[model samples]
Target: MREAFDHMYISCWEWSISVLEEVGATKPLYPPTMLRFTKRDTNSATPGPYSYPAMTLDECQLADFSEFETFDNYCYAMFTFYQLIQQTSGLSGEVNLEVRSPRFLETVASKDDIFLIEGMHCVKFKNDRFEEKVMAHWRREMPVRTFRRKDRA
Candidate 1:
């Protein structure tokens, strides 16, 4: 029920007037900048203990999480880490809906190269070399036009 509530979007949130008393009793606490969490538990070994701050793309890049070429895969890796945390603590009572590399960079499909997946086959290729090959193949068939200013022409 807690997880379901976290995932759901509600138009209304119930707040009690106890906020007035709490605020009067304590120092002013600033509002949180982010709500989503990608927590890690050091005790778990499946997801390990290392992580890049995943709240933003800049944070991920700064943390050198370059192994993930796409955002979806990066998040999948984070989720896996937290899952291991729950599993180790015996807190996982919900069904897991994802299957991915244990660590953020352990993608079973491709790591540092481009891959083409067809049916059950995974074909890996050199991305830069492939681009060059395609360009060379079509270079002669296609013509390039140089644009010049009217005055120069």
Candidate 2:
């Protein structure tokens, strides 16, 4: 599973690079402008490490997903490529993709402490299973006076 995760991450990076090249966009010095990693504790930590890939808005449309058939083919190609890489690498983990704001830095200091931007969704792949979840946290702000009732005094 770890191998799959790593392969997915690497593939994502390569794909991003390819997209930039195809679109004639200036590639950043770093493949990923921002990176976030889950936290670990000494007391209960796993032996292997985990990571994922993230891309900016400018990077997303480079593939020209405007062509549905071509885009679908691209996705299949990515899936097959990663599967082969995982088989050869002997790493066992999952591949997960999440749509997030390019300004992720302003909200999330790290993967474990993510603050979801208004319009992002998380897609996760684990143990050959895929799932999608909304990243937004829904909450209502309460009036301050409600907590400080006059009768309480």
The C-alpha TM-scores of every prediction are: 0.18, 0.25
lDDT of each: 0.29, 0.32
Candidate 1: where is the Cα deviation over 4 Å?
1-64, 67-69, 92-153
Relative to the true structure, candidate 1 reaches a TM of 0.18
lDDT string for model 1 (1-153, tens) is 011112112111101111111222111221233223434443642231122221332332355333333333333332333334344334432222233222323344345332233223223233465344433433443342111222322
Task: Count backbone overlaps in model 1.
Answer: 0
Candidate 1: give the clashing pairs: none
Worst 10 residues of 1 by lDDT: 11-20
Q: What CA root-mean-square deviation does each model show from the true structure? A: 21.0, 22.3
